[model samples]
Structure formats: C-alpha cells, structure tokens
Target: MSRNELVRICRSNSIESYLQDSKDVQYCSRDKPLIQFFKLNTNAAIDGDTDGLGGIIRDSSGKEFAAFSVKLPAEAIHVLEMKAILLGARLAAEKGLTYTLLESDSLTAVNVISEVWTCPWKAIPVLADIRDALFCLNNWKLSHVWREANTAADFLSKPTCCIKRVDIPVVDLPIDLLDIIVADSNGTIYPRL
Candidate 1:
C-alpha cells in the first residue's frame, strides 16, 4: 500500500479497533500480583535548553503509590521520556517489585524501550539503564497509554513555582490530580487528537 493510503487507514481506525484485529498483542494481565502502571511526561523549558520530566507509579488497583518529578539538563522530549522510564524502573527495583507494567504516553519512547523500534542515539544510555533495571524484575511489560489516561503524570511533569531542581517524591496525591485519578479508575474515556 502507498504511504498516503496507510496514513489514511490508520487515521480512520481507532487504536481499540486495531488491537481487536490483532490476536498476538495483549495490553494488560489481570493475574499479575504487582502491576506498576507508570506514566511519563516531558516539558520543554522557556529557554528551550532543559526539560522537566515527570512520572507517576500506580498499583494494579489504580492507586497512586509513588511519583517523581525531575529536571534534566537536556531538552529532548524523547530523551526525557526515556529517562522517566528509567527512573520508574529504578524505583520499582528499589521497592523490590517483581512484576511491573510500565505505561507511558509517548509511544515513541515505549516502542524503543520495548524494542518495537530502534533506540535513538541520544537515548541509548538511558535505555540501557532501563533495561538493566528491568532485569531486576521477574517480569515487566511496557505499553502505551493515552495522555488523558495519564493526566496525573502530565500534571506532575510541568515545572512548578515551588519545586526546585531536585526530584520530589510525591507522598500524597495533589488536590488537583484527585479528580483525574478518580476518572482514570472509573475508566473514563477522553478522546485524543
């Protein structure tokens, strides 16, 4: 098929439709004991030099257990996304969780980490670290999640006035993110452009 035809076909069908057509792919497993759903978001700074990376980890029951936000020296969104995944994996390993399901809003980052696509040169080291961390787990899976489903992570990623350059551990879900977390647990659908 031509490139234009391929693009048109993809745009016409929803992701759910494509997944339903394929039998080999599975997004989640109900039997896993410690599923960690992680979402990463990156924001470019005003100077366009640094990027804010944010990630949140939730358990199988959709409760926000831990989260982190950091500022990277570089500004590439893909790189930041990879770093976020690395951080999430490291956190899971530290917590001694054997089974993890890491999800990200950036499909490109997920594809690279899952070996569905080639890893970019700039993100090689970050991907390596992520891979090493994944080895510590008995089983781990990475998948793409819609941005709307990842609102808490997206909100955590943006630069805040009080947050310094250091990574912050989120002990409690922010007031602003409470509603989004509830919606996500309820499986509320938000259309993505």
Candidate 2:
C-alpha cells in the first residue's frame, strides 16, 4: 500500500477507536456496597416552580436504612442534584454511619463532586456543603450511576408532575417504589435506553 493510503487508514482506525471508547453506557445495575458500608443514592428534579430532592440509604444487604424527600423553590436541576447528595450524606452521618457509598444519577453533579469536571458557579455553595458533609464520614466513595438503576431515587425526586407517595420506610413505601427496591435487592439489571 502507498504511504499516504496507509496513514489515512491508520487515522480512520484511531477515530473509530476513540468513538468506541467514548460511547455512552449501555446498562446499569445497583450494586450492593461493601459489607461494612451503606450505599446512598440520591436524585433531584425541578418542576415548573418547585424542586424536589430525594435520597435513599441502603445497607450492604440492600435493606433500606433511611430515605427522604423535600420540596423547595425551583433551582437549576444541577444545583438540586448536589443538594440531594448533601442531604444524603447528612442523613448517613445522622444515622452514625462511618463508611458510605454515595451515588447520583446526575453525572454532571457526580463529576463535579469527584473533581473530574468543573463546577458551575451556582452549584458551588451546595458543593461546598457537600464536601463538609462527606468530610464527616470516616470512609466514603462517590460515583455516578445511570438513571435506570436509580429508579427509586428518581421516583422520589421527580417534580410536582408526579405525586410521590409517603415517606420511604420499608412498610410505607409506595408499591411502585417497593417494587424497584426489591428489584435492586435481587440484582436486576436495567438497560440504559
């Protein structure tokens, strides 16, 4: 083959490889945390005029420990995402949990908290508070998960568009939420799209 043709083929292959590596995730599952740690997953959303923040904490066995949902004036969804995480961390601390695994469906918020991406100015205050809350934990790790695996938290934080049932205790959780919890505990895998 001619030198120029070989160079062109190599560049095409390089571009294809880059695209493959950057491909969006195709599946997600809610993995249980380490034996001694609790996993907290949180999600947030903005309705026309209201923002809903929610989070759920589950033990290594995937049993629910605590969950919360709060409503407030509408803020950017990105900011609300951080607020949800902050609330989750605080809840774990309140429950005297030392080791924790925090998860969020907002990849942007998770990237910011992990310092993998730049922080938007509006979210800085909430991010600062999140850092403080995380600092209280003796051991912790934070990462992003796909929304499908975050079904329970997503249901909890959806805007006023949907009526979220009562608080998320094992007995009081809405049937739908309970079903999601059970699926997660059973290690059901969810498709990304």
Candidate 3:
C-alpha cells in the first residue's frame, strides 16, 4: 500500500486497524527494513531558568548515527522534555529517515505526544510540530524509557555540558558518555526507581 493510503487508514480507523489491514501489504513485507531508533532527554537547571535538550539516534544494530543538543530559554521541565522530542523528530525528518522509533525518559512527554494525555498550554505548539514531523514519516513509534537506560541523552542534556545547538553526527562518541553508550549497546540494565 502507498504511504498516503496507510496514513489515511490510520487516521480514519486506528493504528491497530491499519496494522491489521496492511498485514499483506508490500511495505510490510518480510524483508522490511530496520527501523531507526532514537533516545531523547531534556534537563533544566536548578533555578529552571535554562533548559537543555538532547537526543541520540541509532540504527537497528545499536550503532549511533546522529546526536543533537540545544540550550533553550527558561521553560518548565515538561516543556523542555517536549521540546527535546520535537527536536528529535525534526532531525530525523531532516535526515530523511522513513521509519523511526523515538524514546524519551519522560513518561509525561511520551504520553502527551501519543495523545494518551492532554498537553499543557505552553507545550501545544511544540507538540503540534512534532506531530507534523511524525506525519511526514512512513512509520514511527514513540515510547517511554527509564532514565537509567537513557543516560547518554541525559548526559548530553545536562545544563553544564558543552554541546552546540546544531545536530552532531555520532562518528566519534563523546569521551564523557562513552561508558554509558557502551553499557546501553551491551544491554547492561540499570535499576531505576
């Protein structure tokens, strides 16, 4: 089925309906390509006067592809988290990724984007932009992860970290986050409260 048809079906019925209907479609064939996976996190300083947003994208084999971080003007933590998700989606779109799975450590942010929870007034615009970005993709998923499992993004999102506003290709992982990245790639689980 064409991507537009799939999107139309998803909008008319539901994701489950579209999946069930498209089981025999060519795009959903056995040789389907691997989906891109990305982890996103955001942090606000002690005074909530400055926020940092970060995200890391990886291929199916767990190899990092791209990473990005940006400092934003003062905002609520939830707003910052939502902004991080928006940035991730925009970056994926810019890179022309057709399929992606975005992970965020903030359950609230994930829920808001998935429409499982209502978005705050301050975050509606950002959430709308994220939705638009997702709609442009052939396939995408958004889910929540434990902060422990998302340490690389968490570290990048630290207010004190010296990350540029532009997206960075992950050719050489930052020395500071090498250990955490290795642990994540090795499937080392960390306890989360």
Which candidate number has the best TM-score? 2
Task: Report clash pairs, candidate 1.
Answer: none
Q: Using TM-score as the measure, what is the rank order of every candidate, best first?
A: 2, 3, 1
Write candidate 2's Cα lDDT for 23-83 as tens digits. Answer: 4525457999889999999999877898899888888988888887888798888999999
Residue 123 local lDDT, model 3: 91
Determine which window of 10 residues in candidate 2 has minimal summed lDDT.
160-169
How do the residues 61-125 of candidate 3 rate in per-residue lDDT, one tens digit apiece? 56666777777777888888888888788878888877787777788888998899999999999
Give candidate 2's error at residue 168 in angstroms. Answer: 9.8
Candidate 3 pairs with clashing backbones: none
For model 2 the TM-score comes to 0.81
The TM-scores of all predictions, comma-separated, are 0.70, 0.81, 0.74
lDDT of 2: 0.81
Error of 3 at 89 (Å): 0.4
lDDT values of the candidates?
0.62, 0.81, 0.67
- Could you tell which candidate, 1 or 2, scores higher by TM-score? 2
Task: Answer with 2 or 3, whichever has the higher TM-score.
Answer: 2
